[model samples]
Target: MKKTLTVLIAAGALLGAAGCSATPQLTNEETCARVKTVVSAQSATSDKAGMTRVANQLRPIKAAASEDLRDPLQTIIEYFDEAAKPTPDTAKLEDMKADYSAAGQTYGQVCGTGQ
Candidate 1:
């Protein structure tokens, strides 16, 4: 009984340690690189299914971004999210385009892309 309890405690400790080790938040450079990759991938694909796939890929990168990059990433995410909606609204689409353009400008300024 004592041996079993000891083994259980060791297992619990190992699990606790693993859970405590969080993934490091992405730096600005890393975030920008990931964003660029996503953009390139998105641009390369013209179909609706491919766009949806790329949008899904952006979710994790958005979640991993540091606080400084969150707003731009969110804008990008919103652009895709709005695009993916079943019933599209013209006004909302226009707003999303403006927001996306603003976000792109911000991203360009920060990352020095001149876009």
Candidate 2:
């Protein structure tokens, strides 16, 4: 759980992700902007609750995101979902960090962020 909040905050801070079910297909720029807006508006509080919320919020964005963003968003969602579990598997969490980092880098590239 210690690592959960850390990764959550890192992902949120770096990517600032989200989208809605009602959202239409978005251009890459629009998707990036929407993600930043959604995440900034709802800052995570507790580890489990926050990670779960983040995962839930990101699913729709993944569905509507540009092709370049789909894989990264899916990876991020998987990270958050694993972190939100009551007893996150340490080995899994350890293995996931590299992928999460890669996803964050992908997000930054796609969104044109320095992060």
Candidate 3:
């Protein structure tokens, strides 16, 4: 009974880890920006492992961002030579910002600056 219970607990932990590892959708700009930030942070930090820890902590922030190609009005005109399409669910952007901020806090806790 003790062995069976331990196995069940271990299996549950593995399943939970697998489920948590699923990647959230992110926008192209967000991905690029985050990658750039991580790379820059890596270069600036002396501890490679520590920098990696910080980057990993911030992954969800980048994942939570969207890349649906919506831009501010002027930037949209500059890129597509027309107005950018309006997003129906703009609140997600705010959520993404909050996620990023939380990630920043996590990074700061772990890496001292969170970049």
Candidate 4:
């Protein structure tokens, strides 16, 4: 019960943070934009099922977007993993690679990527 509540709260907090809001940590726009981009890219490649799976997997981990790099990056990688019956988009994948690189660089320089 405790764990479930914690997860629910985290999901709600993250969902709220993604919408337009003034989260003291970082603006929701920043995190939400990244998540939107990732989801859009996956949808462009795979079927609805794949997109849904990624979205479902991402909901709980979504909180990491506003705080750290590792969790978001890991979530993005999970999206990549969930993609099915679709080929990778080289250009979009390149952009994702750069985003992941940014997160990794941040992790290397700052704390452990907000983990």
What does the lDDT come to for candidate 4?
0.56
Better of 1 and 3 by TM-score: 1
By TM-score, the candidates rank as: 1, 2, 4, 3
Pick the winner on lDDT between candidates 1 and 4: 1
Residue by residue across 6-66, what tens digits does model 2's lDDT show?
9999887766545322556678997788777666655654578887887788888888998
Question: Which candidate should be chosen as best, given lDDT against the real structure?
Answer: 2
Model 3 scores worst on lDDT over the 10 consecutive residues at 73-82
Off by over 4 Å in 4: 1-59, 64-66, 70-85, 110-115
TM-score of each prediction? 0.75, 0.74, 0.26, 0.32
lDDT of 4 at 81: 51
lDDT of 4 by residue, 10-102 (tens): 999999888957424433455556555555564544564665565565554465455665464574555465443267556666667766666
Once fitted onto the true fold, the runs of candidate 3 whose alpha carbons sit more than 4 angstroms away are 26-61, 66-115
- After superposition, the stretches of candidate 2 with alpha carbons farther than 4 Å from their true spots are 1-24
Enumerate residue pairs that collide in model 4.
none
Candidate 4 similarity to native, TM-score:
0.32
lDDT of 1: 0.79
Give lDDT tens digits, candidate 1, residues 1-115.
9999999999999999998887678988998898788778735364556656677777888788877777887887777777766766768889789888988888888777998
**Better candidate number, 2 or 3, judged by TM-score:** 2
